[model samples]
Target: MIDMTTGNPGKLITRFALPLLLGNILQQTYNIVDSIVVGNFIGSEALAAVGNSGIIIFLLISMFAGIGMGAVILVSQFFGAKQEEKLRTAVDTIYIGMSVAALIITLCGIGAAEPFLRLMHTPEGATMEMSVTYVRTIFLGTAMSFGYNINASILQGIGDSKSPLLFLSIATVLNIVLDLLFVTVFDMGVFGVALATIIAQGTSFIFGAVYINRKIKIFRLFSHRMRFDSRILLQSFQIGLPAGIQNLLFCVGTIVLQRLVNSYGPAFMAGYSATNKIDMFVFMPILSFANAITTYVGQNVGAKNLDRVKEGVRSALIISVSTAIIMSILVTIFGRYLLMAFTQDAEVIKTGEEFIKRLMPGYFLLAIIFTLNSTVRGAGETFMPMLASFVSLLVARVPLAYLFNYIGGRYNIFWCYGAGWFAGSLIIVSYYLSGRWKNKAFRFVEEAEKPKR
Candidate 1:
């Protein structure tokens, strides 16, 4: 594990972010492969179904993942502060809590799968059935999904980003192999795709658990009894709850947007889905930098080197924005070709190309917002970031989407994404400029330095 408390900010952030970027790209392949397989084999309707189900799965998973972010922040801070016991407790608490949450979510997701899809106004008949089948199968493996995410978060918190990349590489390759085998050979359609994802995710989680237990000396997962510290749990919730609520709200907004996509028919939906896979690739670098900054700021905050935190954010902004600009250009040039890889349908390809054109310009704005928010969150000031997201997604994007739809129909709805990013960047920039987050970081560091009972 690398320590960020002392290093050249640019190199450290880049070193940490590169592996994460590659891992996120690989992770996106799960969806890309699923889309390609289903769109080519089972047809556009099935592709739409998979895309619709993906949003709901994200909605469910993102809430808990936000809470998981709390554990990650605490882990980074504790490790930086050299509070070894606290770090171990934080890790154990998240594992136990997330495991239980995964079980509960799985049950609720399976029971409510059809109802949720129907509520989203998923197309009637085969689309609805396929969405329900795919979603429920995915939910059944929630434990595996949560398990892997928790492992990755903890490792990231401790400045070990590369290990998660290796884990994801295994899962991604396995997912592709299974996707082709089940969907192509077995002809299992949507069910085959979902099953492949679950099996691959489960393998990765099991492998991560074993690797961590055997190789990692700083903490033990299975070798010792796991402890539940209420203090750490409460602290994690305090830091994570607002972010969780923000994610929940964001997902709710996306569900509204998904309903808009649904009204456009299966072809548009398939196009939108394909674009989303490509979108993940474009945004992965931004996300990687954001995550890296979070850990960088967290470590510096814990070390009481507030200047380094600022320096890291600056370095991150330069790298991430430059990367985003290049990505926008590349996507503009090659997006059509990428869409062609998914399906031969001209309408679907047209719709996806339009999506790339409308949204590519806004990625730099998104990069700025994510970088600033992650910086604040790393310093244990999560509420502001949450508030910023709420304003951007719910207050701005969701409303503008409907308004644009009312004005110019489906074609204009994507404009709201840029508007939302602009709105969020304003909030985060203002907050960062105010410098209140530094006080928050100092308070957290003081707390960390206190003697444990």
Candidate 2:
């Protein structure tokens, strides 16, 4: 594992962020391939079905993964303090907590697939049917997906970003091949794409587990008790529950935005899905750097290196904003070509282009918000960012979306994107500049009296 506590802040952060950026880009690429294959092979209706299910899936996945992220903060802090025993306990507790949560969420998701689709206002017939099928298939594999994500979070917490990247690269290739085989060769339709994803996720989880077992003695899964520790469990929920709720808030706002989009029909749905995929790619680098800042700040905060932590945040901002500007230019220039890879339909292409033109330029604001939140999050100040997200999503974005739709109809929908970014960025920046996170950084338990596991 790379120790981020020392070394040049820019160089260390850049080195750490590159692998994460590549992995996220590959992940987004494979996701786009799912849409492309479904659109070309199964038809736009199938594409719409998958697209409509995206926010619901995000909401579930993010909620489960958020708790794991909290545990990760603990792991980073403990690891940075060189508290081996506490780090082990944190890992074990996270594994136990996340596994149970994943199982419960899977059951709930499978049982409520139809209701969720209906809630999203998915049209009846094939669109609704395929959506239900796709959601159920994906939900069935939540254990594997959550396992991979939680494990990855633990690795990231300790500054081992490369291994997850390697695992994700393997999984991305597997997912792409399976997507083509299932959809094109076997004609599995929407079910095929979902199955491909699950199998790939399971494979990645297995690989990550093996790596952790071999490389890190503390993460030995079978040797440790799967039972939760009361203190650790409570701490995990304290940090993670709010983060999960933050994710839910963002996704709920997304689902709300999607419902507005769905009212325009399948053509718009397909187009919006395509653009959203590209949007993820465009900001992947910024988000990756933001995450790197979290780990970087996390370890330094644990080590009580306040100066280094502050330096990391400043360096990350420069890197994130510059990268965002470059991406915006690239997307503006080559976006049409990217959209063409997804579909040949003229209407779909036009709608996607419009969405890109409307939203891509505002990514500079997104970079600022993401970087600042990640820094604060690493300092273990999760609640402030969570509240900021609620304000941005509930207080600012949702109402603006409805108002825009009322005033200008379909064309005005893009207005919500800019308003949300600006509001979230402003709120987070204000909090970060207030310097409260510095006080929240040091909460380390003394290593002398370690709890028995």
On lDDT, the candidate that comes out on top is 1
Off by over 4 Å in 1: 448-453
lDDT of 1 by residue, 343-435 (tens): 999999999998899899998999999999999999988899998999999999999999998998787888899999999999999999999
As a whole number from 0 to 100, the lDDT of residue 175 in candidate 1 is 97
User: What lDDT would each prediction earn against the true structure?
Assistant: 0.90, 0.86
Candidate 2, 1-453: lDDT as tens digits: 879999999989999999899989889988999999999999989989998997888887787677777788888888788887778878888887777888888988899889978988898999999999999999999988887887788889899899899889888999999999999999999999999999999999999898898988665764646545668767667667888889999988888888888888899998998888888998899989998999998888778898998888899999999989899889988989999998998988888988888787788988998899889988878888898788878888889889988997776787777788888888899999889888777764443245556
- Estimate the overall C-alpha local distance difference test score of candidate 1: 0.90
What are the candidates' C-alpha RMSDs? 1.2, 1.7
TM-score of each: 0.98, 0.97
TM-score of 1: 0.98
